[model samples]
Target: MTWNIAHTAFPAEHRRFRAVVGGVDPDAIYRAVHEAGGFRSWDEPSRDLLHLRSTAIEVYRVGDRWVLAVNGPSVEAVREVLRLLGLGADRDVQELKGA
Candidate 1:
């Protein structure tokens, strides 16, 4: 399996982070976020703060990729979420060898 990960910083929004992952399984990403206590439902209302964590993260499907947005109080918090999700600044597609 091959996947692409990209990161974008929202400077206007206090440097909030948005990670766009493409060419991967959206369901897998959704499950990971759900297990990490993040919001997975799209029907929920959007607010200034949605999740309980200070670094509020939301995972949703967009086309063939999963868009993970982190809205936190600080850049460190947002980066931490990205790290936890295994998404880095590298946008190159990665391939799995065995599986």
Candidate 2:
């Protein structure tokens, strides 16, 4: 699923993390997400998600802006993501495109 994650800075709290649940090359997507800066991948995760939790990167923070580039048709999966991350309607999640 495609996500346009924007905040005022980079995310710090690990449990508050979000990630990709798609069928694309996450390695390449990982590289692309931070090209403009504001995010970085964590070498360790509290748990594993398809071997990606460890390598999954942080795209942005609550004080800045970043984005999640879904490799394929996981577009409708963003809500599940937010739920997984514990982010509620309280936080401002701006969907940049139409699914």
Candidate 3:
């Protein structure tokens, strides 16, 4: 289903992979990114943090840009979760895949 999350997050921009992540909380952000599709591989600046187990997921940068995912789990139950996160959106039949 297509959650209206795009509107709440990026009122100025249409729905896109980056907008969702950019709007959501940073906590477990890596997982969100991972679930989306792909992610960046953390480098030296993050090497020390890895030893501390502080980050959620591994990341790496590409050409001075970090790797990112464009795919995440379905919008199923997304409405509630997004609201819990203080985002404005709605889930509906249209959001469901192969409905």
Candidate 2 weakest lDDT stretch, 10 residues: 46-55
TM-score, every prediction: 0.44, 0.24, 0.24
Evaluate residue 61 in candidate 2 and report its C-alpha lDDT on the 0 to 100 scale. Answer: 26
Clashing residue pairs, candidate 1? none
lDDT of model 1 at position 45: 27
Best by TM-score: 1
Candidate 1: segments with Cα more than 4 A from true spot: 1-24, 41-52, 60-65, 89-99
lDDT of 1 by residue, 1-99 (tens): 989888977555333344344444445555556667776435432212225356655555565555555555655665555565667634332222322
User: What's the number of clashes in each of the models?
Assistant: 0, 11, 11
Question: After superposition, which runs of candidate 2 have C-alpha atoms over 4 Å from their true positions?
Answer: 1-20, 45-99
What is the model-wide C-alpha lDDT for candidate 3? 0.33
What value of lDDT does candidate 2 attain over all alpha carbons?
0.34
Tens-place lDDT per residue, model 2, 1-99, is 999988677445322223333233334444444442324434333221222222233332222323332222232344433333333323333333433
- How high is the CA lDDT of each candidate model? 0.50, 0.34, 0.33
**Ten-residue region with minimum lDDT total, candidate 1:** 43-52
Model 3: lDDT of residue 33:
42
* CA displacement after TM-score superposition, residue 68 of candidate 1 (Å): 2.6
Q: Which digits, one per residue and each the tens of the lDDT, describe model 3 over residues 1-99?
A: 876654445344332111132323333444444454434455464221111111123233445544322222334334333333343445231222332
